[model samples]
Target: MIDFDYLKREIKKEKVTSFLVYQKGNSIFEYYKNNKQLEKLHKINSCTKSVLSILVGIALEKKYLTSIHLPVYSFFTELFKEQMDSRKLDITIYHLLTMTDGLDFPEFGEWNSFAPMVYHPNIMKFVLERPILHPVGTHMNYNSGCSHILSAILQKVTNMKTEEFANKYLFKPLGIHEFYWYEDKMKINKGADGLVLKATDMIKIGQLILQQGVYANKRIVSEDWIKTSTAPYFKTYDSIGFYGMHWWVNKLDEKNDFNYENTYYFALGFGGQYIVILPKEEMVIVITSEIYENSLLPLKIIQKNILI
Candidate 1:
């Protein structure tokens, strides 16, 4: 069992802002820095990516799309007919999900201000024009642009915007109230990121995945889809780290670590928002923080308290 008292003490000691944990759909622990319930409508940053991944899975299950192996350009051929090179045509949805698109773009650059001068003119055109540095499926490069491209594909294939499709099929059914998705100038939700939801809603998302895409007896997503999304596909910047779809997979040794084989996967966001799903322990951990510099602190605390 997790030591709630010590966990709370450490959170307070380490200046954690808000933390909550749910095991098998039950609230097991909670703490707030200022003794406040984090608004259920706060921006959750890139946790939105995981949500988008779920949507893609749903799209696949519905047969609206074929498979991740299909080349991305195959779906958006008309948009890039003139500029689509053989290298670009080689890119696939699986590459996008695994962040192996090989397209050139800063994964963490200052795009907010630079959007006016560069991206606003023609985002897709600019993205396709970038140099491919590696063969698809051979490298793991974090690219927000790749995710946005997937989102655009989702819109084109589904004949509905990502936000609308998710709202109707995923969010509404899961009771994810009060959320917003930022859009590009072309009015496409930056499905690669740019979603804001409450901390509890984040937990709900984790829970939904933990339950294998089931919600309150309703099959919102398929078990097969969940398995594929959570399965490790590529390693990120860190050596031990790997990514599965849009989710980050943390590998821990069971013999050396208490929660070994537990396989704690999570949806991570910038500025310290996380929805962690510990399947073996039947636990879901939700954390929100303003300490962008110390975002890993919350994960470290949870690892120490529950998985050590």
Candidate 2:
């Protein structure tokens, strides 16, 4: 059993503003700096990517989109036709989902601090025109632009905005009441980032995945989609871990004395939002924090205390 009291004390000691943990569809623990007031919706940042991944899975399960193997250019000819090089035409939806589009866009640092690319009028055109740094599917680069393109593609195929599609397929089905996604200048949701939800809603997402896309005995997303999305698609940074369709894959070993069964995956956001799901343990840990730095420390503690 996990020591909720000890975990709460440690989190408070570290000055974490807000934290929530769910285990097997129950709120196992919660902590907050200002417990008197209701928690406000905080910016989830790049955690929106993981939400987009789920939306993509739902779209596929519904046949709104054809398949992941379809070339990205096939759907968005207007954007990719003359702008993208011939070599880039081979890029597929799978590559975008795996963050292996070969584009030179990086999510970190001050690259676009001077000018926000998401607000730019010709954002897709600008992204399409960037020189290809490597062959498609050959490398894993954390590119928010790739996710943006996916949002556009989703809009094109479904004939509805990504937010609308998500609301219809995902949010409504999951009974998520309060949430919002930021829209680009063209009024498309910035699927690479800009999603906000309460910490409890975040936990529901993890629970859905832990149950393999089933909620309340209903198959919201196909089991196959869940398995495929959570499976390792490509290697990210050598130091961090493997990337699996917008989810992070972590391996556990008995040498580490972890109670987990060697494999666990999680959805990570820029600030300190995590939706960690351990299928074997039937555990789901959802954490929302204001601490912008070293959010993974709490996750490590959970692994050490609860899972191990």
List model 1 lDDT by residue over 1-308, tens digit each.
Answer: 77899888887776456788998899988777664556646566677889989999999988878998989888778766866457888889998888888765665445431222135555666677778888867888767777778888999899999999999989899998788888888777887657877777888899999999998889999999898888877765563356889998876664443232557788877666788988888889988877667656777777788865
| Local accuracy by lDDT, each model | 0.78, 0.77
Looking at model 1, report the run of 10 residues with the lowest lDDT sum.
Answer: 109-118
What value of lDDT does candidate 1 attain over all alpha carbons?
0.78
- TM-score each candidate: 0.89, 0.90
> Which candidate's lDDT is highest?
1
**Candidate 1 runs further than 4 Å off:** 13-15, 34-36, 82-85, 108-119, 254-260
Q: lDDT of model 1 at residue 100?
A: 84
Q: What lDDT is reached at residue 33 by model 1?
A: 69
Candidate 2 has which clashing residue pairs, if any?
none
RMSD of each: 3.1, 2.8
